[model samples]
Target: FAKFANVNDATSHWPTGEEVFTHLPGTHAHAPLIYVALMTFILIISSVTMVLAVEAGHRMDKKAVIKWMAWTVVGGLIFLGSQVWEWSTFIAGYDGDISTWADNGTLSHSPYGGQWVMGVDAHGHEVKQMVTYGPTLYANFFFFITGFHGFHVFTGVLFNFLVLRNVIRGVYHKRGHYEMVEKVGLYWHFVDLVWVFVFTFFYLV
Candidate 1:
């Protein structure tokens, strides 16, 4: 829908239609991107820990595998917690009314700030209305896509915990291998890679 959007059309713009459907520079909501960078770093480090765990498993070192897997699990937990905080903050909106726009020949006000309202248009089509405070669609996509990835992280942690349990039980040792650790490590690393792309496209860009 965004590809063929009419950039000059007022309907294409946000609430009050003073601006288009894109992040404007110098806006208050365009705060520092530090948290996203930190999240990326955390996930990337977790991938490295998974790699170390896999290497330890390859060498039949149960103690080393347990240590590295524990670190990887810790990293995943931290990342998931941070994502929850970010979602909460976004849903809460900004502190005060920030929507300002020039309509026709006069300035007007949209008091809701970044809040989004849904209603039927005159033509009976469903519409997602946004104020000048920020893009509502952006928040929607962010929540859905990032929330999905966060769920993946949560499940990856569970998988890691299960393998860690088996490691402690000497199951892999009895089998003369730690293939389970390697498999879970691969899944965890793939989760990290997906986050890297999401962070880059959603937060950084």
Candidate 2:
């Protein structure tokens, strides 16, 4: 849907001369990209910690499992916090008008409204062009996709927390195996892998 929105004709959905579907506000300062990179780094590190925890579980090393699981939880938390910040920045826009409207819930006006550009025509005549920033569909897709993935991450974190609790209580130890840790680790790794695709399609493209 996002790809379709981006490539579809803008005459019916957006104003004329809209070259893109989403005009991320912080492109000049590279702020959005930096935040994305940071979040990706955090998730990658969390994946490593999960792997370590699983390895420790294989060896029945309770202390090592606790240590790595704790680190994984920390990493998940930081990634979530960073995602919140990024969402806030995206919604508010660099100018803050979108944030104001978002709070008011009034859609009569929007920051995506196009601006007039004065330039020379092909015939060297001065002409004024109405250049649209983008459409609101971008925001819709952004929130829906990222929020869906965020929920998955949240669930992964919750599951990890539960498994960690069980580990602390020696439940896995009593079972003579740590298969639960490995299971949760698989889920964590899947979540992290999904984020890589999301980041690539949403930001890199």
Candidate 3:
């Protein structure tokens, strides 16, 4: 990648690597896969809980509905929290030593960039350099996409919380059915399924 960037920098007449880093979209090659996998797992489990809640609602099982709904809410919270951690780590960027060549034919070490590069030092020892200043658009688009989904999760949590509160107050019990749980369950399921697409296109693909 470093060689490619250097060759492009040397040849390109248009905007190239010499200027601000140019970022292309759909580059999930370096994304944290394990964290994404965990989040997917949690959301899938939450969807299952929603299905169980809807079934309990059909049977007018208030206790079962409340229990499953609570579990769903917990799952949503955990997913959101994981996202917070992931975002923080991403924004922090990579931490490593970098190498740069000066105009005076001298090489030096730096901590500027997080990307790795191979080079030789004054003693003819091979060393690794890091590339800094990643493309801004990549991070911007990432935040926009993930942040939007995070907001949806936040609202879903609040919605579930309200319904859970009502359940505890016996409103559904007096009404002789847990229809509200079923309704919210539908929305929750939709959100969970949409996230699968987001995870695939944004993180895995």
The model with the greatest lDDT is: 2
Number of the top TM-score candidate: 2
Residues forming the 10-long window of minimal summed lDDT in candidate 1: 16-25
lDDT of candidate 3 at residue 34, scale 0 to 100: 53
Off by over 4 Å in 3: 1-32, 94-135
lDDT of 3 by residue, 1-205 (tens): 2333353345322122112121112343333365577788999999999899889888888889889999999999999988886665454432321123422223322235533344443332322112222343334555777788889989999999999999888899899888888888888888887898777655543
TM-score per candidate: 0.70, 0.71, 0.68
Off by over 4 Å in 2: 1-32, 95-135
Q: Could you give me the TM-score of model 2 versus the true structure?
A: 0.71
For model 1, residues 67-118, the per-residue Cα lDDT tens digits are 9989999998988888786665555543332232332221123336644333
lDDT of each: 0.66, 0.69, 0.65
Q: Tell me the tens digit of each residue's lDDT in model 2 across 99-141.
A: 2112212221233442222323322111111212224455656
Error of 1 at 92 (Å): 1.0
Instruction: Report how far residue 162 has shifted in candidate 2, in Å.
Output: 0.5
Task: Name every residue pair that clashes in candidate 2.
Answer: none
Model 1 residue pairs with clashes: none
